[model samples]
Target: MNTWRARLLPPALAIVFAAVLCSVVLLVSGANPLATLAEMIAQVARGTTAVDIVNTAGAYYLVAIAAAIGFQMNLLNIGIEGQYKLAACVASIVGGAISLPFGLHAVVIVVVGAVVGAAWSGIAALLKVYRGVSEVISTIMLNMLAIGVVAYLVPTFGELRGNTQGTKIIPDSGQVPGIPFGGAGTMFGLVLLAAAVGVGYAVLIDRTRYGFELRASGLSSTAATAGGVNSKRMVMSAMLISGAVAGLAGLPEILGRDHTFTLNFPTGYGFAGLAIALLGRNHPIGVAFGALLWSFLDKSSLTLDNIGVPKEIVTILQGAIVLSVVVAYELVRRRELAAEQRRVGRALGTAAAPAAAGTGGERA
Candidate 1:
C-alpha cells in the first residue's frame, strides 16, 4: 500500500494542481472551464481523434526515451532535435537510394539513422570528454549547425518534388504499412517499435552493469569513479546510446507515413520530449503516461476553439502540470526520507531497549 501510494500520489496531486490552476485561468478569461474541459474530453470519443492521440503518443514516447537516456548519465542532450532531423535526412536518402530485400531495406535505414545520430552526438561527447566543454553549450551549437548541414545536404542530394525539395521517396520495400484502426485512421504499425524501445530501456536501466554505472555516474561522478567505473567512458556510451535512439525518433514518420524527409517535417518534439521526461521522472512507464497525457492535451486542445476558448490554454495547463509534478515529487521525496528516518530510529530504539534492560538487570 505504501509503495503504491509512493508511486501514485505525486502525479495524482500534480494533475489536480494543474487542473485547478487551469480552471482559474479559464474563469478569469470568462470561459466556462467545465464546459471547455468537457468538450476536450468529448473529442476523444471520436475514433479518428483517439487514433491520432495514440500515434502522436508513440512518437513522443520515443523522443522522451532518447532524452531520458542522456539524462540518466547527467548529460543534457539538447541536440536530440537536431540529431533526429539530420539522421532522418541521411537515412531517407540512403533508404531511397538502396535496393534490398524488404526487411533488410528497413533495417538498413534504421541502422543508418542510428549511426548518423550517434556520430552527430559523438562530436559533443568528445568535446565534453577532452576539452571540458559543457554538453549543454555544445549541443545547442550543434543544433544550429545541423540545421545548416541539412539545408545544404538536402538540395545537394535531393531533388525538388513539386514545390517541396526533399530526398528521394523511399521504395515500398523500405516502408512499413500502418495498421487499420476501424472507421478511424490507420494507426502507425511502428507504435509497436515504441513499446519495444520502452522494454529495452527498462531492461537496460534495471538489469545491466552499464546501466548501474550510468546511474552511479549521474548520481555522483566522483563516487562512481572511486567505485572503479570510468566516468568518461560512461558519458560517451550514454551519449552515443542516447543519440542512437534519438536517431530513430523520426523513423515512424519517414518509414510509416512520409517515406521521405522534407523541410516541413514535424518539429518541437525534442523540447516537448524533454518536458515529458521531466514529468515522468525518467521512468519508462512513467514516461509512457506522460507522453499519453501530453498527447491528449495536444490533440484535444484543437476542439477548444469551437467552444470560444483559446487552445493555448492547454499550453498553460501543460506548463503547470510539469511544474506541479516536479514540486510534488520533491515534496514526496522529502516526506519519504523523513518517514524512513523515523522507521530506522524506532527500530534502533526497540533493539536498544532489550540491551538496556539486560544491562540494568545485571547491575541490580
Candidate 2:
C-alpha cells in the first residue's frame, strides 16, 4: 500500500462507519437521517454560516494545536482549559486598563495571554518533573483553581453595566479588525493568525531538530535518552508551548468578536481541542480539517430543533466518529507493524539460507 493511502484509509473508513452508525441511530429514533444530513449540508452553504464556521474553526485550530504539542511529547496537558481561561482574563484586564497604539496594543494583549498561559502550565510541568505528579491530575486541579480565581476576580475588578458582568471593554484601537465576506458576513481577522500558527507548527514539527527530539521522546523516553535527548527538557518545553498556544484559544473571541472576558465568554474549547487533535492524529493539516468539521457540526446543530430532529443527534455522530476513528487507527497501526516484522523476517531468512547452503557445499 502507498504510505499516504495507508495513512488516510483508516480515517476514511472510520468516518463511513460512524456515518452508518449515526444513520441507524436516527432511524431507530424515528427521524429521517437523509433529511437531517441534507439540512446540515444546506447550512454550510450559507454565507453567514461560512463566517461562523471559519471563526469557530480558527479558535478550535489553536486549541487543537495546543493539545497536539503536548501529545507529540507524550504529555497530556489537560490544563489547557484553565490555562486559556486564565490567560484570557489577565489579557483582557491588561488590554482594558492600559492604552497603546493600534499595533502595539494587540501585540501586548497577545503577549500577555501567552505569558499567563505558559506561567500557569509551568506549574504542572514543575510538579511532573520534581514531584512526580501526573499532569492529568495537576492540570485538572489547576482548571478548578482557574475557575475559582476567575469567578472571584471578575466580579471584584471587572466592570458591571446593569446585568452584563465582564472585564472592561477593549478600546477600538486594541481590537482586531475583521475581513468582510460579502454583506452581512465578516470573518475574524485573527483567522489569519490561526493560519500562521498552523504553518509555524508544521514547520517546527516537520522541519526542526527540536521537533525531532520531541517526537523521539514521545516514542520512548528511555530510547530518546540513550540517543542524547533530554526527556525532561522536552517535557517542560512541550508543556510550555502547549500552554502558550492554548492561551490563544480564546483570543479570537476576545479581540475579534467580544472584546472582553465576560460571564458569557465561551468555555469548553480546550476539551474540544483534545478531541480534534485525536481525530486529526496530531497532524497540523489533519487537525485543521478536524476543527472545521467539528465546528460545522456544532453550528449546524442550532437548526436541528426547527426541523424536528433532535440536536443531540450531532453529538452522537461526533462521539461515534471519535471512538470509531481511534479504534480503527489503532487496529491499522498494529496490522502495519505486524506486516513490517514479517517482511524483515523473510528477508533475513532468505539471506541466512544462501549463506548456509554455501557453507554446506564447502563441507561436502
Candidate 3:
C-alpha cells in the first residue's frame, strides 16, 4: 500500500491541482471550463484523433526515455531538441541518397540517426568531463548552433521539388511501413520501436551493472567514486545513450509520414520531454502514461478554436502539472523521510528498554 501510494500519489495530486488551476484560468478568460474540457474529452471517440494521439504518444515516449536516461545520471541534456533535429536531417539525407533492400535501408537510416545524435551530444559530454563545464550551458549553446547548421545544410543539400523543399525524398524502400486501422488511420511503425526502447530502458536501469553505477553517481558522486564507479565514464555513457534515443525521437514522423526532413520540422520536443520525464517520475511505465496524457491534451486542443476556447489553455495546464508535480513530490519526500526517522527512533528505544532494565536490576 505504501509503495503504491508513493508511486501514484504525486501524479494524482499534480493532475488534480492542474485541473483546478486550469478551470480558474478558463473562467478568468471568459470560457466555460467544464464545457471546454468535455469537448476535448469527447474528441477521443473519433478514430482519427485516437490515431493521432497514439502516434504522438509514441514519439513523446521516446523523447521522455531519452531525457530519463541523462536524468538518471544527474546529467541535464537539454540539447535533445538539437540532437533529434540534426540527426533526423542527416539521416534523411543519407536515407534518400542511397537505395538498398527494404529492411536494410530502414535499418541504415535508423543507425545513421543514432550515430549523428550521439556524436552531437558527445560534444557537451566531453566538455563537462574534461573542462568541468556545465552541460546545461553547453547543451543550450549547442541547440542554437544546431539550428544554424541545419538552416545552412538544408537549403544547400535539399532541392526544391514541387512546393516542398527538404532533403531528397526517401524512396518507398526506406520508409517504415505503417500499421493500418480502418477509420483511425495508420499508426507509425516506430511506435513499436518506442515500446522496445522503453523495455530496454527498464531492463538496463534495473538489472545491469552500468545502471547501478549510474544511479549511484546520481545519488552521490563522492560515494560512487569511493565505490570504484568512474563518474566521468558514467556521465559520458549516460549522455551518449540519451542522445541515441533522442535521435530516434524524430524518426517516427520522418519514416512513417514525411519520408524526409523539412526545414520546418517540429520543435520543442526536448523541453516537453523534460517535463514528461519529471511528471512520470523517471520510471518507464510512468513516463508512458505521462506521454499519453500529454499527447491527448495536445491533439484534443486543436478544436478549441471552434469552441471559443483558446488552445493555449492546454499549454497552461501542462505547465501547471509540471509545477504541481515538482512541489508535491518534494513534500511527499519530506513526509516519508520524517516518518522513516520516527520509526527508527522507536525501534532504537524498544531495543534499549530491556538492556536498561537489566542494568538497573543488577545494580539493585
Q: Could you say which candidate leads in lDDT? A: 3
Error of 1 at 43 (Å): 1.3
Model 1 per-residue lDDT tens digits across residues 163-242 = 98999999999998899978988788778888999999999999999889899999999999999999999989998998
Q: What TM-score against the true fold does each predicted structure earn? A: 0.95, 0.96, 0.98
Tens digits of per-residue lDDT for model 3, 1-364: 7677777899999999999999999999899988998999989887699999999999899889999999999988999999999999999999999999998999999999999999999999999999999999999999999999998878888888677679989999999999999888999999999999999999999999988999999999999999999999998999999999999999999999999888879998888999999999899999999999999999999989999998999999999999999998988888888998999999999999999999999999
Query: Would you list the rank order by TM-score, best first?
Result: 3, 2, 1
The residue-by-residue lDDT of candidate 2 on 239-320, one tens digit each, is: 9999999998899889998898997788899998998898888889889999999999999888888888989988888888
Select the stronger candidate by lDDT from 1 and 2: 1
Deviation (Å) of 188 in candidate 1? 1.3
Cα TM-score of candidate 1:
0.95
Clashing pairs in 3: none
